[model samples]
Target: MLKDFRAFIARGNVLDLAVGVIIGGAFATITKSLTDDIIMPVVGALFGGFDFSSYFIRLGAIPADYKGSVDSYAQLKAAGVPLLGYGEFLTVVINFVILAFIVFLLMRSVNKVIATVEREKAAGTAEPAAEPAEVVLLREIRDELKGRGAVPPTA
Candidate 1:
């Protein structure tokens, strides 16, 4: 069972998947930072410095013991306030869109490469793979035998 598990882990697909997952996690962090730091700031500047993340609707009253400012979304939320954080949701949506677009572009390029290779193959322009050494050696032996008349030549 351990050997079977090792074999499964050593498979190309499994290794590829593991690498993809790690890259995906790193990519997600980059996307989040891009959305939160660059894009959102630019958008806010365009909209006269209006912060979208602070534009949530308060569904419940602030706690009596809460000392944080009522206008701050993070503070109110930390104070156990029930609020509809649509702005934060919008930021997450933007991040997802950006990530999806990048992935789409990557897939598109990969598909283009695959199509070009297939077309080259169909046109017989692609270089043929080299013959294996064993096959070449066997052919050499056959030629030597045929030259000596030990192996009959084909009609």
Candidate 2:
């Protein structure tokens, strides 16, 4: 069982999957940064600096003893306020869309490169050129003549 486990771990697919997971995790951080730091900021600027993440609706009434201001979503939530966090949801949705688009573009480029490599490999490993039609006909005729003893078969 130990040997079998080791063999399973050593398989090419398993190793590839592990490596892919590690790389994907690292890529996710970069994607998140790109979305949060760059894309969202530009989008916010376009929308007159409105922050989507702080948008929320209070569901439950604020407690009388609550010391924190109910103005901000974070403060209200921290003060145990029931809320519908639509802004945070929208922010997450935007992040997801950006990440998905970036991944799609990356995968498309990778697929194109893979396809190019495959085409090159196929061309490089192609069979030698075929004999011309005239050559084939002449060869067949020579073979028939030789078989009928009308021509000698050359070594």
- TM-score of predicted model 1? 0.71
lDDT of 1: 0.92
Q: What 10-residue stretch in candidate 2 is worst by lDDT?
A: 66-75
Which candidate number would show the highest TM-score if scored against the true structure? Answer: 2
TM-score of candidate 2 versus the correct structure, residues matched by position: 0.73
Tens digits of per-residue lDDT for model 1 on 1-155?
99999999999999999999999999899888988899889999998999888889999988889898888999999888999999989878888898899899999999999999999788897578899999999999999999999999977
Clashes of each: 0, 0
Candidate 2 per-residue C-alpha lDDT over 5-53 given as tens digits, one digit per residue, 9 for 90 to 100: 9999999999999999999899989988998899888999999998887
